[model samples]
Target: MFKKTSIAFAVFLTIQVHSAQANAQDQTADIQAQAQAETEAETKTENNSIEKIAVYGVRQRLEKAGMLSDSIMKTEVISAELMQHKNAVNLTEAINNTPGVRVSNECSMCGVKRIMLNGLRGEQTTILVDGLPVHAMIAGYYAVDAIPTTGLDRIEIARGAGASLIAPEAIGGTINIITKTAIENSATVDASIGENGNRKVGILGTGITDDGRTRATLIAQYDNRDQVDEDNNWVNEAPNQDNRTFSLRVSHDLTDNDNVIVRYANIQSEVFGGPMLGNTFADGTATSVAKVLSSFDDIESDMLFEGGDVRNNFIGKAWETTEWVNTQRDELSLSWLRALNDDWNMTLSASYSDHTQDSFYEGFSYYAEDTMWYVDARFNYFLNESHLLTFGVDKRSEEMRSHSSGETNPAYVSDAFDYDVLGLYLQDTWQTTDALEINMALRYDHVQADFIDTSKPGKEIDQYILAPRIDMSYSHNEYWISRLSAGKGYRAPLSFFETDHGVLDAYLGFEIDVDKLERSRSVTYALSFDGEQLSMTSSVAWTQVDNLAMLTKTKKTDETDGGVPLLTQLDETATVTTADIALGYAITDNLTLNVTAERFIYDTAFKSSYAIAPVEKRLTFYADWDINGWDLFTNLVWIGARDLSDYGYDGYNQIDSNGIVVASSKKSTHAPSYWTLDFKLSKAITDNIDLYIGVNNLFNYTQANEGESPLFYDLDGGYDVAYIWGPLRGREAYTGIQATF
Candidate 1:
């Protein structure tokens, strides 16, 4: 692995050197011209008699507040500059620092991270790239960590139902990742290494034609991390991962009023965890239960069952404790923009994605393939100088198939699904006055789904839905703004992989009985203040979801067949309420401080299948300082506690090898609160080079430190690997260097 990484780094350096040599002359001339222009501007300013206020990039807090106040709905932006300050390498690490957003791991073995918005699960959020829904179910499961931050310009977030015009399934919120547009010639490379065998490297390049009509950008990145086990149980607490990604984008002007953009991206990733022995045997065959149990002969018996008797019984079946997954994904997208006249404009876009996975989970072998296609067309018309009308039509189609084989069950096919949706929407923005604006929109959708399940009869479903939204923004004064919004949204049933991938190991098969669409209604109110030295924003929201899908397990009664479990869903209702506040103050010309606080309340009838409980309260503090040529940043986050018994995690029944209950152990009901601190420092060594160092989780805090383990056993002696609520990894220090030419 080290040799390969070295070779790749050498190639990247060679490319950068060649490009620098080619552009050296042009760069020198541009620098001289820029200095001359600056000198002339300074002279003009000195000669002028009138006084004027100067604006600087140091006042980014006020600028960001202005962006939020001017939008029709509440929106948040995460800039690339902030990501750099945090020393983030992937999308998950960057977004996790933002207020009102939570990223949690769903599986200890696979390390599948899920993004939660406004107290809702990851499945309810719609993730997009450049306003296109190319990250489908299978790919989305891993995209959060596989996507590199090398070429991102910014990220836009909107929380609520019907926040996007084209995506109707965004019951929780919408996240849009925007890429940078190349307008100049530049190249950048970054590399970092840390504890636990962590390593990362990335390169970004942008170029524009001399005619100023064509632009292009390219990015490549690689990341790897080793597994960690703190309890000395020969089981990993954190999964091992290896990821690689590449992307390219190009834009061209075909005519004076027409432009086209094309983009392509590819990702390959692998994850493994569980027993320390690895995923397979020496001969590349599946490891049997006897073979795995024999490897533990040297360990003491008491250490194996320290948690409880149920946990001990689970440990007896060693074959059901390992997991491994390998994935490959490719995406292509295109967009065309045309101006019909001064009052009318049009846009057409299309995208396609293919994802494939090969995996081994708990003595089972599962393979899957998924493909998606999407198209969109929209037109905007300016009417009477007071109103702007926008209308669009979009269609999305997806198909997924999987094959599975296990020790107790015969080889069979599962999760064969084909789904299609067509949507049409119209929106009008009316500027009633200079201080007030109103936006009203409506959308209609037709959904169709077909499923082929071997455990039960095939099923087909067809449905139609209508959604409406309205938003009003009023400027009370120069420094104050108030906004109100209400909307309705619906979501179609998703594939099995999107719901719970771990259930595949425990269940023989699944049945589809969903008869109604999952629907939601939401309302939000926000107030903001943007001043010279202080800025503040606050919001409150409520959402109610009906026909929420929930899963249930059923056991086979026949003796001839193994007593395997089958899974299905039931319709239910859930409600969520949230309140958030953020404040920023410029303490000095070179220092800034910020604080954010949020609270969430949930009323639901079903427990999370992944054993994840919502956090009730959270607070974060941030500080940035710049002195001389050095920059420093610090962050602190506090997470509140929850009642575990309320989520059905009270205790587990002790069972012997013959499945006989003997005793029970009560578990801790109340989880304690915890906090973490991070710090980073960077300085520019030259005009084109920078050096940085950082420490994450400075206190080396983890759940194990609090005597709480993520592994838990149930009444039936089946273990759950997703009982997590806090950080699993400890402190780590890293240093890196960046170069630009």
Candidate 2:
């Protein structure tokens, strides 16, 4: 009895001692956290007047306000500082790492990509440069590659239908590129070389007048990369590219409160891909018939046995497979901003752009020329401290002329289309109280479209659309904010070039009616928190689309049918929902961390006909550290899998005796999830010089390898590069030097 009592007493004492140690550890952790918080609080108080825009490029981050004070839209700004830290080669590469934004590969032969936001297709988004309209119509697909970050100030992305106030076609989102203004004389040059035979060089120069009233800036860039064969099938997975661009901007201050800016840019690019290196027949025989035949013919035959269509009904013979892209584009823009008085301001802008494309794919040669003229006038009125109103009017005209020839009867044909639009908009912002704000905008647009078939002039189609938006924001305190917004977006009928590239000459006597305008309505809700060391924003949005235009197969009703297929426009409905959470934390005086999570879902009744494949969830993380003149930055992205059409890459479905294709037992296949990591390190040698090195795809991840083949071509013998889900190039390492004076 005495021994049992003594053991129980010793156990009780041991338990008490363990509890005391746990308490001590907890106390120590709390004290460290408190000390860190105090240091951050002191820093924030000192930088209260500074703007807290993210700085990642050559400059380091400075703790300041967490949000913008000028606008209420949920905008994410990426500065040139960040772009340099990420080692982005172009505008498309610079903006792709952000959450809710995707840069999609549309053509393997040309390495063409389009930017998408909030689960919507690339066509619904708008690209703006310095508040001017450009890169629309036929140029939208290939123009993103031409934009370089030589003299860029920043890039702003607003992800949602309601985020667009100046652009009516921004049903998905808006990407605005702001250029830097010269305040003092400066010059910068950089050069980089990487794996896969990649090479790049850029130069920028800025000069200011002695009186500080006039400034001029010039930028030039040259970049090239070799084609890569991911699967060792002799077929290029990524196209070879040779691109060059030159730009000039001049700004003059007419008065103390008035200024005018003029800008001009020219771009020339060439891209080459496919298995054939030169014009040659499938056999060992050499044939120079203005086109190249590739081994895809044999691959197509095998696909037919696996239930692939292999249909070239319109074109008389199976077209030869050749891939090449050539383009020339030029742009000029002018803007004048004047402050009429203390309570009023006026702005006027005008721009002209032209683009020409000469491309050939699978025996079909396509030539296109596009030109656009745009003008805008805006007036802002501050009626009182509580109310601000803006009125704007814009006029735009675009013309596209395209032609194609090869591999079909009556192969030579021309198509011409014209689009004209006039728009008027009014926006009002009312500060009901210091913490409550309401904003409303209404716009009316009239669009006129006409198509000519060289032989016949079609009747003109006119459409009138009304778009309205309302947004409200309530800030409970400096640390908390909430917002809600609803908006409507509209898109005019598409041009012939926007559809299939083979529609013109491939199909004899093909005809199509002007499609109805596409419209979208969306609503968004958001909440935000701001603190000395932590900042976060959470948002959810939903969008519904009507009269979505698409190309569909139809029976030919012409007298010379020739048993060929015809293409026509069809309308469909779709819904998209997106949710996002973004967080930023200052881990230490020289370290910062950021994380973002996004969920995107898309649904449509015409599931079989829809072509979009969206990921259900995505997560992105970024870290930046600067200490002792050394900077280190890293970015990681994780993408979730979703249902998508295999497109016959994983063997084909069985076909019955009947001509109709037998449906595969698997309706949808899950795209494999993927992760990519990138890192960069830089050291400042002097105030005006720096050295940097970076690695993209640090783990050598790729969707296709030496043994695996990625499906880049569809079953119908058409180019199908949209099935891309991951990186095509495995890894790239580059080092460069930047110098400023």
Candidate 3:
């Protein structure tokens, strides 16, 4: 069916192109005559008195109204002004409020979060900084929240497969963080404090050389938040975090048509969660069993196990219930752009990143180090007046090494591997007519991966992938526009962390079947309308993934050991279909209102144990009002229910050591829907300073309050901490001051 549709679409595009070319040729004489007439009339009016008419700030107004974008790919932009209104301090907080996008918490204990685009898993999405693929898989676990929003100009989001030309692994979508390039002699500082010991301070500054050829921008931020245990179970629902980030960007104009940019960034973070304690386990304060058990109360102690014998079995492993992670990341990137002539231009870019993590989970200690680099070269040619061609080559490589040790077991190396991908792509932008445009792209990637383990023989895998994409845009009139896109993309699975949580047992090792590749195809259609007072955008997308990678525990049998986990591909296919609509209206010159609605449908032949269940429906409403230098922003979000049984979260019976059922968890087939409200108000105290206050989750809505626990115990007394479906934190109020000089 897909092949047939593709063939038909190609035929239709060909017909449109031919018809446009014929029409252009036929109207050549008319266009020349009109131009001549206009010239003569202009000469006649030159001597007469002329009246000048000027219009200002129309584009800015449209952008503020959320109705202006000039990309053929149906991109969405989260502007800095919008981020300030929402009181966002990081990338995760900025994009989570956008339609058709979600950031979900994977681990309740450590507060591990991932972004889901159009109902796809986070690993499938490619995150880029200034159009460079410098975000590594290991860094992705925390970078979304760690990256500060100080020096950013905006974030560009494109959904569906093949959304990026250089990053072929973008099976879900792409997010590009664009930084400020034009420099001015200005500096801004902001500080805020909130509940739960939350506090943040940030500074951003930009400067230009006297010659006006070189410029630099610097940003630094520090953020800290304490842990929260709302249910008083001694198990924290949110982790305590201390994070610091620094970034610098420098740009130089070498010639009239040549420019170079250099960027460096660093992040340091420490996170602690799980059973509450007086101090960090890393400080040796809670390393002993007695110290660990002292933090728990009688209710928590009784809830730890089904019976006394089961509790006794875990006497010396009390430390296993806690988690701590320390992470550090550094990155550097360079880009050069030069125009050979008016018709030819090229770009050269490269980036390198290093990430390291030391962490312990459930009594197991693990350390990981990852290094990655990317290089890209692109050339563009203006073939004719209506056709432009782009050719590019990209090379990316990544290496990771990890070690794990249990409470009583010695440390052993695990998941030590490296992979490289070389890609070549060609894209063409054809302006069929004044009102129509189309882009067609094709990419080929060669991948090689090697797995190294001293205890076993090394394994190697090689694969090749081809991806194709097409996008079409047409303007019906000045106010109405439409777009359609389709693409095929693939990912070469090389690491166990891509599919499962980063948990390792000291005695067990992973066996990966790298013979198959994860592949996907997606189609999206969007229609938008822009007017004086009202704007609307509606889109629908469909995506299907084949050979999905899944981590499974081997069954114990006489033929082999069963407790070891392996990474394997599932035979069934997984699919997601989503529809989204957004509307914006200017109620008055100083007030604007926006509303968005999204619906998602998920289908799979097999159940998943770790993946977040997709929400079926979501609605959001936002209001912005500015009065006499005082601004107000408010939003209400409604999240729909999810099927718990679909993700292996069906309630289970708790059995004691004597093989007797002590308790049974209820079968929560469908989670309840909920709503949350947020508000921010800012006032200008002086010409250079502003004071702001805001509240998040104003109603104090949480999953625990809704009778759903993120931590669930199975029949054998083993607990799972991934059963999260809704918000974990309650109401939080914060106040801050911003100053510019």
On TM-score, the candidate that comes out on top is: 3
Predicted candidate 2 versus true structure: per-residue lDDT over 5-118, tens digit per residue: 111011100000001100001010111111111111111233244322211110000001100012355566777888898887788888885767878775555677767787
Candidate 3: what lDDT?
Answer: 0.71
Displacement of the residue 585 alpha carbon in candidate 1, Å: 0.9
The lDDT of each candidate is 0.68, 0.64, 0.71
| Candidate 1 lDDT over residue span 1-741, tens digit each | 111111101110000000110000101011111111111111124344433222211111111211101126666667788788888888888778465677877777778877877877677788888878888766767647888888899777777899888777889888888887775678899999998878889899988665555678898999988877655455667877888999999877665555688999998888877765444432233253335533433222322243344233223333445677888889899988765654565779999989888877765667778899999998776564556677889999999887766423443325678888999988876667766767788999998777765553544568889999988777798777777889999876656555665544433554455656678999998777777777777888988888666554534444224433333444557888889888888788788888888998887553444346767789888888988878999889998988876666644434455543344454466777899988889998875688999999998888756656667656565556766677888888888999987
Model 1, residue 484: displacement in angstroms?
A: 1.6
* TM-score between model 1 and native: 0.85
Candidate 3 error regions (>4 Å): 1-71, 279-318, 406-413, 454-460, 504-506, 556-562, 606-610, 651-663
Estimate the TM-score of every prediction. 0.85, 0.81, 0.85
- lDDT winner: 3
Clashing pairs in 2: 56-81, 56-82, 57-81, 57-82
RMSD values, in order shown = 10.6, 13.6, 9.1
lDDT of 3 at 196: 90
